[model samples]
Target chain A: MVAINKEIVTLDPHLIGVDWGSTCLRVFLIGSYGEVLATRTSAQGSSSMNGSAWAYEQSLEQLAGDWLQEYPDIKVLACGMVGSKHGWLEVPYVACPSDVNAIAARVMSVKGVDQRRFDIVPGMAYRPANGVPDVMRGEETQIAGVLSLRPEASQRSCIILPGTHSKWVQIEQGKVTAFATHMTGELFAILRQHSVLGRLMPSQQNELDPIAFLRGVEDARQGMYLGFAHQLFAVRTLGLMEMMPPSSLADYLSGLLIGHEIQAGLGWRLAAGLEQAPLILVGDPSLCAHYAQALSHCGVLNASILSNTAPVGLWAIERATAGVHATKLAHKVNV
Target chain B: MVAINKEIVTLDPHLIGVDWGSTCLRVFLIGSYGEVLATRTSAQGSSSMNGSAWAYEQSLEQLAGDWLQEYPDIKVLACGMVGSKHGWLEVPYVACPSDVNAIAARVMSVKGVDQRRFDIVPGMAYRPANGVPDVMRGEETQIAGVLSLRPEASQRSCIILPGTHSKWVQIEQGKVTAFATHMTGELFAILRQHSVLGRLMPSQQNELDPIAFLRGVEDARQGMYLGFAHQLFAVRTLGLMEMMPPSSLADYLSGLLIGHEIQAGLGWRLAAGLEQAPLILVGDPSLCAHYAQALSHCGVLNASILSNTAPVGLWAIERATAGVHATKLAHKVNV
Candidate 1:
């Protein structure tokens, strides 16, 4: 293995990357080149595991212990929903672009807290143009870790992170200046499950026709004259089906919402010949792929799909405080 | 009662009434000397009860079942939501200024429906200036009923019927020349129930503050450039609680949406003092109170709030039909 960078104390390769969440805790034992070596997993979801320190802690300890049995002395990296209030050690929210070290500052050494010492990561916060305050617990780390990997994306880029809550974050040189979170996910859920529109759509989410999806993008770009619900009903009442296929409705809903988020985030004249601003998307491969396709319709062709930084964040945390002191030793020599 | 000329049926005294669907559907049971008579009642509602007959049919059945028990031979009429797909038998919609008899003729008789020999009134429909087709179902009958009660309202008047689906109807002379239904109710439901805004609001619908409600109006008036959802999240995110109590979020939501509707419906020109057109409101006293309050914000003072007209519609239908019968008889004589 290549010599370990003294500036960052990490094994030539690391032990495991831990992501403890409300539902599931995933562990990725990765190598130096970010290749996942062996995966040892355990079932210890936060929400399900009542705030008991013993059983839940033991579940994680067993996971790491099993990994150590294989390598005997590999380092571990962890981040994600595992650092929240209900997470393993209750790591707090960190301000954005503060670097991997500041995030690790919140990472406390829990003696007997677990089988070994592990650091927890913090999230990020944003204030939007409308002056509305918003925060993301795990996604911030991913964005930062992603930024850390590719410095080029740090300039004049908007990150469309789609999830249950789609967040459009404005980043300028490694700093998350502002962001807006659109309730696209919840809207989809309610529309598909609760609202009358649900009747017209499939019982399950599936492929949306491109034509219908584009119509939704046009509506979002138009920006005025209809409420989300009003616009939603119009799709049914105005006989959008007369022009477009019925199955396209779901795709249209997803496109309409995400396009609106993009439109709002990229606050310029949305009408007329479109602007060619590049969009950096951080989401599931399938969704971001669709979103990138949708963006291309509006002349946003240079859209880059960024890999998820959850594992990168876990790696960053592990490298910050890994076996045999990387950063500390590097700093001593530099001084 | 004095035996008046059959031609004088148009000048008959009528009842003041209310319908179930949060809007109008009223009739007046008045004596020959304009004295109040027995007022018949029925539950006013508009949800599409698919397994059952049209909503209005059920409404008519309920009223007829109750009233026939008392005045078996008394003439009855009604209007508003009951005139919709959910209302009394499906009345084929007529284009507006499109009057009383046309509505009656279009009314479908529900087979083995509500045990009554009454005609349910239909509203008006029209093609908009934008070339998109639009229509109203139940409110037009009441507007006609209102004009029948106070013919003076017919002289270039604007009737504001506020509810879930608020309609601002224009009456030139005795005709409802045009009208548009704002999906205010649908917007309200989505805003209050499904949006990110729901979190900012209190679980109890009643706990609203008025000052914030007024700001909701101003926000709409000044053009906060907000998509209706922002008005909600603003309350919690901006700490609008500092400026106005959170209770007003409901009213603000109501006024902001309605005001936005007015902004859009009145065709961008509504802001340059919409008071140039006199507004006559036809709705329940409670909702009318809100309409009056909102209209004052738009600076249209002393707007008239007429009594709901489902009952008057019931009576007006009888009067109009009676006149038609008289005309048939007189034409027969003339021929």
Candidate 2:
């Protein structure tokens, strides 16, 4: 077995990568080459854990205690909301345009129950030239994983992490130059669950009706001049008028929000002069599919999808940090 | 006093105007001159009453049974969601571009427990040339009231009724020609109460922080290219970075939504070539103030505010219907 360092004794089952988000915790026991050897997921997200140190420790122990027991010195790399102000430990954000090395260097360390250190990757913050600052906690890791999987994407790409807060990130030469956060998913959830539009729709999510969804997307694309809030009213009107059934209304609403998001995202890319950059979607397969459909509808036909890249990203960061430390140690030994 | 009908009615306690909506029931005792004599409001909105005919009858009786008893033949005119599909009696929507005459002609009658007939005014539906159909429940009556109060508005005007579903109506020659619904208020409410952005703001809405609000408006004004959902994330980032406090985030969010709404409404107005039409704000005074401020900021200088015009609107509809009925009777007699 290849030695990682004095601390991480083996390369196989090389690292423990944790993607701790607001509502879910995903753990990956990764091999040296960034392959996920085994995986575990739980609903014990950071938010549910209430940022309690003991709870976080207990959760980690419960989820991957055997890995810690079997490989006593293997390093752990965690990302996402687990690094936020209300996370296990408030790992500060690394500002953009940041590379894997910049992110790796800024990771904060916390001790597990056995006193072994775990590295929590810092999130990235992007300040627009004149608007309010934008921030992403877990998406940076996903983007990193995309870069690791498709190295060319690192040179020039626009990676979209489509979820609650969808991020359209700009990458240049292996660094995230800038990114914007779109609240499309969150808006859809709230609108479908709480607004007047929700009343006309079935309480539960219906199956995605492709025709209805595309209708919504087309409406959004053509009705951009109508304003978003106005366009949203169609959700209710369509249901009331029986133009769209209750089952399809939700899909329509989803399409409308996603459509608007793609329109805006494309505009953002065009404005950044990254129009020629390769476009990539990184998220849940189904969500990516919806985004892919929307992007294709928006005349973007070349966008590709990558699923859950957190493990590889975590691996990349861990290795980068280890190399930086190894170089520092060698320099000291020579001196 | 003047005899009004064969059933024997005086003109002083002219009509009972009810503004029964989704969340609240507002009743106005109006005089012959369309002036409100007395008003009563209750939390028994149509939704809460659950389309229970008994509950709606009881609500109206409890609030204005005295007036009904005093003038046994007095006419009653009700508007808003009270006539919705889920209301006391489902009145079909009067298609646009409809005036008071068309709306009054379609008024449906319902019998009270005492058997006195009451009129429920139909809402309006506007199907755009190439988009989903738009519907408004009670706002049609309010438009009628605006026309009565300011006759010149009938020639050409834009009346903005700002609320849960803010309606930007176009009036041409005393008729609601076309209108657009912007869900600004509802959107703000849901986003402030449910979205991730809501978590950064104070649970209890803080006092309007004007500076923070204006800042958000300006950002939305200049950052239209960034897409609405993307710009929404600033509500969270601005709070996280300590650039803006939690208390101000809600206001900032409000400003952003309102600003976007105004931008869209203005664009709709411009597209319809009604730029020269007088702009009027008709809704809650406080909400109108906000809209007025937003409108002024967007370079529309003279938008005026008209508060709760439902009473006059009901009066106008009742008079129009009475005139129509009288005409029908006289025509029958002549024949």
Candidate 3:
């Protein structure tokens, strides 16, 4: 009934930042300085809740009810799939090149049970001139977090958020110019669990083999001409021939898919003449390390990994929205 | 108990040809003229068997017991996963560039029930001069069937067998010189069934949309620079953006995967300087037709479709093995 690992509670919670994604609901109680004073997480993700309006309110209340009671007027901001069409509310995507101000301007505010107010962040959509459009939900806030921490990055940088759908984003002057989504993690998970490649791997995962992993990265780099489907077949042949142990096959496959992602991502970067831009990865530390290793194999060495950027990102959006409101109030008084 | 759609019974069955793959068992009663007189099939593919000698024997008997009983001394030749490591017996792969003679020479012979001899054709392995090795079990026999039907194709040809693991094989002078395997079909199936992309598609599959299919193919060709994982995201975005209906998304995805296969297959062929080689597709007519259409979209106009090559291929291997035996007998008499 209570939040797990209920950390030191903030007596004066300034903001409540919720990173509600597809499968996990995480709420961060933020202090005035944008520090996470306490955190609560539950298995109740947006996808798990019933589509009914009360279900979303009930799920959020169950996780952060005590904090809400103590700080009745605390500004609450949530991001990610919670705003998706299938989520608690459908927040329209803000078209890129978007910035903190642009995103904050479009936040969808909703009234909860007993008149509690919550703001949901709008995601970003990118329509390339010549190709299909790409979209990202919670990652926009993560990118905002990166910009919050490293304002210099906003001048010109490429930030990669690796997960189910890894985003390779390009930022210029605090605005997201364009970004590409690579379904690396999702593909790897599905292939490992459902494809024939999974049959060759040990059911109990083994420690990652550096040699096999690097070999897969190298293979993906050199085998780009053959495309991915062909290169992936190596996972089977390598195991069938006993070239790699069963334990190492999964790691090798991981490296292979990530390598393909990096290869394509770098190509996307280079094609746009953004190769010299500062490259940073924002997400889980270990996953970023793998991406860094694969990127280094492909001659990219400037990628830095940043973790837990969502809360700060939420803070940044709140400040931007408040600033816009102040300017509007000032203009109204002058009129 | 009788075979489904039991056609004209062969009065004198020359050979019992079996194509046992991962999920199905098929038997062809070949007449003296190489025509399939009566055919039998079952769901007991090599993968479903118990891996015991009797299980395979029983599976075949269950399908063609009447034919086996009437033709006691009839030569039985089986191909595909039946000779794989997990099949009835592990048949070593014959190295490429292998002809019918080389493949038949490595045919693993096992004694079935009642002391009947069964010959399982060896699969082919291609260890490319560079990169990882590739292997195929039953497709080799299908290639041999192609050779039998069109002798000139042996001089130089590129044969594509489109299926779960689509193969782009090169043949020279009746031998399988080299090949590449694309996991297009398998990847499509898993992605459709398990991945986030599938979430946007209708649970009940709709008819193929040619326009959407071609759009995917064209996008794949133009978007090769972004790699497959990136191109694949379009399937989700198109649906989410409501640019394409749920019904057409699956077809678009199919086109995207097949297009990547074609692009990569063409690159592999061009890399080997076999661009001008005869391009022939052998497999299920509908599937092969899809590949053919995708290939034509890529500016490849000469691809011809051939169906039911496995039975003929089994017959070709049988004849080649018989000829080799006659040659050895003559040589012994001469000595």
Candidate 4:
């Protein structure tokens, strides 16, 4: 993942950065030079909104209107949870290689039974060509957008898109080949606020202590082999001195969660052969760095931090399209 | 556990039953045998009073005087949480083989440390020859008393003591040979009230579906080969229709937790060995029945219930020595 030149954020006229999150909806209006003319935020988050039969129109009017009303017509591209089944609009799920065209073709902008005009971005879906089925929502759009920027990153890279439900997508040759998600954040919250350990926890956001967090990782590896539940008892009954601070226990829970995911997602390789390929971790620098640090111990030496490219990659869908294709993807113009 | 023909609510010349639970202290004065002469309960729970100190004397004099005023010289055998470290009196933990003699030997009574004349019962202590260390509190006394009633239960009996912390102990030769405890009840409360599943669950307490509860047992078995943290995700995400009712989730979680203990406790057995031994389950009959039913599926064929034997067991200590040994177990006793 290479750093973008200074002009990238400023000069992409067709660029549009959209953040479709679990709890918030946000869209930024960018100019031909990638300059933000305006931004829109809404209370309805991804999981809460409907298929947009009525809502899609209202949110789109507010979001796309900020720029559309002025330019009265500059074409735009959208990404993120806006494509979810419950978003402002329901974008059909697309299987990956998942270029702008595949997703763009699935966009729906028809006035619904309620008479609303708004376009929906589509997400990526993966079915077992061989194993269990899985799906990805807004992240694949960003991954494609990310790869579009760095063509070299199109092959075999791990993209960590973090949030309450963070995803780690495996991209190969310009498409989101496969991926898995971890509910790390949610688990951390539950453990800290709800478990017996709650008594020992201090009320404050805690930092991940590299020293302590690593112990958790070690314990998970040791403990996963010995039943994590009983081992949890060991933490308390061993006495306060031996028990990791409730905060650290939180981290241990997180590590154990991710470790189990790695076990499931990686399977056989986790058994002493995870070196099949290097791992690329995205999201916030600190967390990705922590995951990378732990993965390193498991023998994955190359861990790169992918840019928080969700916004950049999301916005790039416009840049990746042919001018004719862009116009064609939109509602037919009437003059 | 044996059942007495005498009633618990009537009055006679005998002493009443005293229930010293972790949270409350209750004294019941019954007839010479087991008839309730008169009953009075108080808030001076086991932990609230200082070591068989002044508070016990003041409270007991008033409480006992309520009914025992007639007999005036009746003896009282206290049981339950009062024998804990925080109870009116701290009784030393008796080692296994345990019986009334050991319990009677450890009884301590002080007159308010200056005035109260009450002998606090002692629980049992167990340190495995090889295994993680743990301690038993009130359950030991209950088990000992129950053992006294069913002497043959000594050889190959399984005791199920349920509460905030539930323990399953295997007894052989009239001794609590080995045991494992799971905080099933506490975990149930925490998960139902605080975790994300809290959303999926209905607020009202409803009966747990045996199917769901059984699924929890099945899911908990994942502990043997997988970390529980991940296994829980399956329940949350897939929303196993079986484990859906939040109320039953407790029962299910209990099944899982208890099942884990049973497996761990009996892991050394060869195939098809669970049914080979007799099992004695002590607790609320209903809950004990559920546990026994679950164990039966795994081939545990012989499980019997122990009636309300906790108090009787404590009293057996007094009956065995006729209160003579009470003063002897203390650092020094004056009566």
Candidate 5:
């Protein structure tokens, strides 16, 4: 489905960057001037495609149908769980110390509907000193975006992507040196939604109480007397003792999980002689704010949040591969 | 119901011990000599009684139908979740530094279906140095049984009751001075049954592989580089890496949870200057063995398992109150 007049389409949009994650698909339309022209998002994630490669293609085509009709030759750059084993096409992980260029170089291309090209970015694998291998999918792109936006971050920084599987990544010279994954978010969700602790949580939705959340962080920080397993029970005990309200239970749990994560992640960094390193928090604003607050509680004064870096990261990776693909298209048009 | 001839029941059986828990009800028929004449068990626990006091009484009557007929005047001793807030009757917890006598003195009696005496033992509560209030119900009775069986356990012993919410109690001079609860077993079950980690486990039931369990225990023991939240992901990673089979995931998870529990429990005990104290493990045999294995892995050589101490503890509590109750009953008979 290559257009006869490739020159005409080349004058349209430069790149269409997509972050196809496990549960959500986010797309960014980048103009020739490297600016975000338009953006779109859908609930059709890798998981919802139901393991069918064809279903993923159909969903992608449907999602990008209107844009493709206007700019038929726009190249698509994708990242995250869309490249996982359970995703449409499995992409191999680039072992750390990997940079944006290294990740961009290993991008796997799959034939999209009507001859459109889809470039899927590879994730990063980290084997820490503990010998257990840790991996991250979508966060690598965010990290790439962070490095792209702030080149100063490349010198030495800890970028934390807080979410379901919160990641603590160490970057040096724009390369991810090492990283660890904490199941804090997932654990908090499950405990609050499915465990006995759920019974004590308020039925109605309540805005996160910062006071309660900080108290939880304090509980975890000062809870050297007991491990997390034991400290977790305090959530219920405190509720039973009327020390905290039912509505605050969620925030408290969130604080406990996030606090414990920071303690472990930062503690490791401190032990490894990176005590003075700058920290960058990345994710949704609310989540990032929580992390920043937790960091402050731990006396980490230099932490800052990088707001909405996934699109920037996707655009950066797309830019790396744009020249090569552009040359190929130019040659085809001349022929 | 009380028999018309009180002498017959007094001759028949002196005590009927019941461990009415959240999900199961266990009853022990004790002769005047304190030997278990017969036993009965059912799934009609406090939870199954569905917040109805009448349902609990009816369920109790049905469970002890034959025993009640034989010895209508038999004094009943009950413990466990039966006295919880949502149980048949909410019995107040006896604050710690509580022994068999203290617990027996606070035994709550409920009006039975007819004239039978239903005596429920009070649970124990401990506010540790960390100032978190911890409570245990049936396990305290088991601890009482441990103390009854081995009086030496009364002097600076750590009694570990391994189950859904495992309790580690510090007993000094036959008194439960303090205790802590670990959501290890509950956490393991939820992680395997509800979390994403369950996806890597086998669907079919497989026997607990000791080797795999020990590996998990070793992983937790040596996982100082990360917290349990981070190390838990190793279960999924190891499965994905093919380092461990899907079938062995259950056993491995068991090891990790139990290992973490022991580490936290024993670590606290050790910190409290009980490093040389003997550990008395009281629980079901299978669960006890796993804890024992983990304890052994942790280099604790003085650990012993106390199998099925509920009956002994129940009998002991019963004996404590038998004289006073009998004297009251004789007074009634004379009147």
Candidate 6:
């Protein structure tokens, strides 16, 4: 075991938290007071590192080598795809309705070079009312982080993590009761890049046109004779007729996809008599904003954006596990 | 004008009918009685010939070189994508409700090498109840062909042309009244090739498994809480669970897409109080079979499959135009 430098432990990072996903690697160095001292992000995601023999440890050292050298005693905590089957370790998912404690208890640890300790938070698996199985890797940690940060969120809330595979999760009493996944972003990407609709869109553009997007949202909300498939064709026809400009076609397509996702996901919950609760939006801010706008269009007025919940989630799990270890040691001393 | 050989026109051939689509060129040499005396096909579709200066004439001569050499007096009639804006020549769309004669009256002619006559049939366009404009090129001719072949179809019928852009047309009194286009096949292709869903599917399969496809159809018909977006993720989840074999995933995906399309397309017609008339399916036989199965699953049992409608439709249009020309000549003589 490496010697722990007690004097520097207080001033240096007490914990190194990571939110590693399929396409990105983000690390946060946190002080004893749970404040982030330094952070680093890289594009070395699980997909890029899958072929390496020791991808997890190699990628971690590559990103945080200098920080680790400066603070060797700091403990590392990671959540997300790092624990998936294709990631660092294949950590089995904790079946739902899982709380922070349950997830904390199931945390798996690995030893890197010089006996450095790495604790990985396991993902959550859910079997919804539909009987189809669903799994989420990184979002569970975000939910835990959100619960820890916002005390009122422990009562009840619907959390949405909008990204490639958008996750709609429900939390009651600080436990994840149920959640579902939608391939909204992925579908939109493929359709826009590889399908016929791509022909009408401008090759490159940064900002989205609000009017075109809202029009798409309005069309989806109407829920008339045209479904998503039929409505998609209208994007091309309207573009051909010069009713909608080619540059705005991408934004309009974005609105249609997000609109349909919201209608199917939240609309079902609304139909089931679920009361209106402020939705916790997590993930990239730009993507979350789109979801928030779509939710508002659907009359969902209460949505709060939560940015960078991954570090908080990892910190919470680390604290819970450390507390459990401390309680076990105290019990032994008493005996 | 090229000299017309009387004996060859009466005995050998009178019309050269062509079905030119985005990906294929099919030509039929028809005799005086509208019987197909010879046939030829090539991969010279509109998309393949888009860059050529005189693609329409060049592709025709390439496919029917020998036929044209033997029957120099033959009048050529072409339909399908050959008349789109990006095609050989842009023929204006005849707005529905339009009869066979109305479509024939708008036929545009082009002069090729050596004064060869090429008459192009115009496609049909419609504005449905939703006020969105829908158009079809090749299928319009097939609908006219179906009406000619099945005389009883003149009263009223639903014609389905299943392909990349599947057209669902409604005909009343031998005229196309309304129609809608669904991007079902395109969606399926893109999802299977470029999306994450493709990862769960097997790369190669010779035939579709009926059992797997029917299960997807059943799932779609159930209309459970899970919408199309949600249900799409199930394909991946179910595959990971080993509940669905990778080899059969393609067929299942096909059924889900086609099933949802049928539910939206024909299901709307059913909801509109239109009585069940046998849906006249015009397209490739194998593709029609899959649609036939899906329609049967939806309880629309009366579906008649019309194979090679492109040639028949071209023949019918040629006959109509010839009769009109003869009437105008006789009227001039009477005056």
Over A1-335, each residue of candidate 6 has an lDDT whose tens digit, in order, gives 11132323345567898988889998888665455656778998987876453777888889988888887787888988888777777789999999888999999988876687888899998876756688889898888777767768777778888888888887777788888888888988988898878888889985789989988877766753455677788778778667889999888888887888888777656654454765888878888888899889888888888776777677777888776321111111100
Supply the TM-score for candidate 2.
Answer: 0.93
What is the TM-score (0 to 1) of candidate 3?
0.95
| For every candidate, C-alpha RMSD to the true structure in Å | 8.3, 6.5, 5.7, 8.0, 6.8, 6.8
- Alpha-carbon runs more than 4 Å astray in model 3: A1-6, A324-335, B1-6, B324-335
lDDT of 5 by residue, B106-152 (tens): 89988866755688998888876656688888988888777766766
Q: Write model 1 residue lDDT over B154-179, tens digit each, in one string.
A: 66667778776677777676677776
Give the candidate number with the greatest lDDT: 3
After superposition, which runs of candidate 2 have C-alpha atoms over 4 Å from their true positions? A1-11, A324-335, B1-11, B324-335
- Comparing 1 and 2 on TM-score, the stronger one: 2
| A39: Cα error in model 2, Å | 0.2
lDDT of each: 0.57, 0.84, 0.86, 0.57, 0.79, 0.78
- DockQ for model 5 equals 0.56
Q: Is candidate 4 or candidate 5 better by lDDT?
A: 5
DockQ metric for all predictions: 0.19, 0.77, 0.79, 0.19, 0.56, 0.51
Error of 5 at B167 (Å): 0.7
Off by over 4 Å in 6: A1-11, A113-115, A324-335, B1-11, B324-335
DockQ preference between candidates 1 and 3, better one: 3
lDDT string for model 4 (A1-335, tens) is 22232324433345445667667776766554333434567766665655544664456566655455554445545666666555666666787456666665665554444342344566776553432234566676667545654556666556666555566666666666665555556655665576655545557758865665665566556544434444444434433334456566555555655655454444432332334554556666777777777666555667676655555454455544433222221212111
Clashing pairs in 6: none
Q: Return the TM-score for candidate 5, rounded to 2 decimals.
A: 0.91
In the range A36-67, model 5's lDDT, one tens digit per residue, is 55667799988888778788888877787777
Number of clashing residue pairs, candidate 1? 33
Instruction: Put the candidates in TM-score order, highest first.
Output: 3, 2, 5, 6, 1, 4
Clashes of 5: 0
Shift of residue A239 alpha carbon in model 3, Å:
0.3
- In model 4 chain A, the worst 10-residue window by lDDT is A326-335
Q: Decide which is better by TM-score, 2 or 6.
A: 2
Q: lDDT by residue for model 3 over B163-222, one digit each (tens)?
A: 999999988887899999999999999999999999999899777899999998999889
